[model samples]
Target: MAATLRDVTTYDLKLAAPLAAGFVLFFVTPLVILLALSFQTDPQGGHYGLTQYVNFLGDSFSLGVLGSTLWLGVKVTVLTLLLGYPVAWLHQRSPGWARGLIMLLVLLPLLTSVVVRTFAWVVILGRQGIVNATLSWIGLIDTPLKLLYTEGGVVVALAQVQMPLMVLPIITALSRIDPNFADASSVLGAGHWRTFRKVILPLSLPGIVAGCLLTYAAAITAFITQSLIGGGQMLFMPMYIYQQASTLQNWPFAAAISIVFLVSVLVVVSIFNALGRLSRGYANA
Candidate 1:
């Protein structure tokens, strides 16, 4: 028994050491670098101090950007869930060749570059673009409305781009639910809505929470789509950070903002995870 235990311990160390090193390199390395840079001086010699954080936290403009970014995140998350749930249900219900085709269509965006996707939105949402042209043709509006470069445009663009990320996980989760459970509930005289409410929804909560978390985090830090679609008017935290770091040459402050965004995402995900745990316990009970 001692010999067997010794071999198992040796095998575990062999498996864990490389994984631990890779984890540190992949996750810890950048965090260490960012923390160091956040305390370093920039070209303006603002000095190594909490001034960067203070400037980020104290400025109303920055606060407004943070608020807008948070709101945008929430909107995108909700919209994704709204669309993703139905699509996931469809995939599960069909789970056939049609489902594969539908999934392929849903995930096709993943194969394309984000820049290309954003540019596509620019074309579609432009003043003389497909959407406005269609509206004008139908006499819905006499003139091309200002659709591009607005909050609405940003929301739509973000939703379209982050959709696949939301749908895939949900469909995966939904497909795993045993249909027999639903069948049994229905045969027991539980109506469709009741079965869905009591069984299907509760089972899928993990996936829904996961999808929401992914969409929210991606929406908050999204730079390319936000920058292009927002038309330099909207100020998301990620774009603001880019402007500060590259355009304004304020590395320290940029680093601080980056750290702030990172912390915010971590906190949000942590809260969701805690809620997820409590929800699982409650549902199981």
Candidate 2:
């Protein structure tokens, strides 16, 4: 028994050593490098200050990037919820092949590459694209409406891309809810709207919270979709960071920008998680 226990311990240590090393190499080492570079000066390679951070905060360009990214994230989250709830509910209530079809449609984007998906949006939203041409033919406008290169374009693209993330969680949550609760509410003379507002929404808050967090996080860092659809005019933080690190060759400033974005994303997500928990508690009570 002692020898068996010793062998198990030895094997565990042997497995953990490589994993620990890989963790350091893959995650920790890069984070440490970013932290170090975030403080270190560039060109002069002098001792560091908060100059990069201050510059990022003070620069109107960088500030605009942050604002746009956050605003787009909010828009995407809200729009996704509006569209996703119905789809999720349908999926939950669906029978037989209908449920399978709905789920397949919801998850179709997951199998496709981001670049390919964005390109497809580009075609659909282009001036001579299907949407514009259809609208023009229907006498909506004499000209092809400018869909690309605007915030609206970015939101539309993002919502489509992130819809699956929203739908899946909400459906899962909705599925766990007992249909008999709605039946009971009806038996008690509650209408559909009241039952949904009081019962269904409360129970599904967890899934809503999870989906919103996932959508918001993805939107905040969205790059290719924003770039292709926004025509480089949308300048979100990720794009700004990309330019600073790759184009400008300012590693320290890039690192600082990355850290700032990381903190901002974490703060927003924490707030969302907290609200979700509080709402869930209130619902239970």
Worst 10 residues of 1 by lDDT: 3-12
Q: Candidate 2 regions off by >4 Å?
A: 1-22
Worst 10 residues of 2 by lDDT: 1-10
Q: After superposing candidate 1, which stretches have Cα over 4 Å from the reference?
A: 1-13, 41-47
Candidate 2 lDDT, tens digit per residue, 79-190? 9999999999999888979999999999999999989899899999989998999998999989888898888988999999989989999999899888999999999999
Top lDDT hit: 2
**Residue 155 alpha-carbon offset, candidate 2, angstroms:** 0.3
Model 1: colliding residue pairs: none
Shift in Å, residue 275, candidate 1: 2.4
> Per-prediction RMSD in angstroms?
2.4, 3.6
lDDT of 1 by residue, 184-263 (tens): 99999999999999989888887788888889888887889999999777788988888888999878888899998788
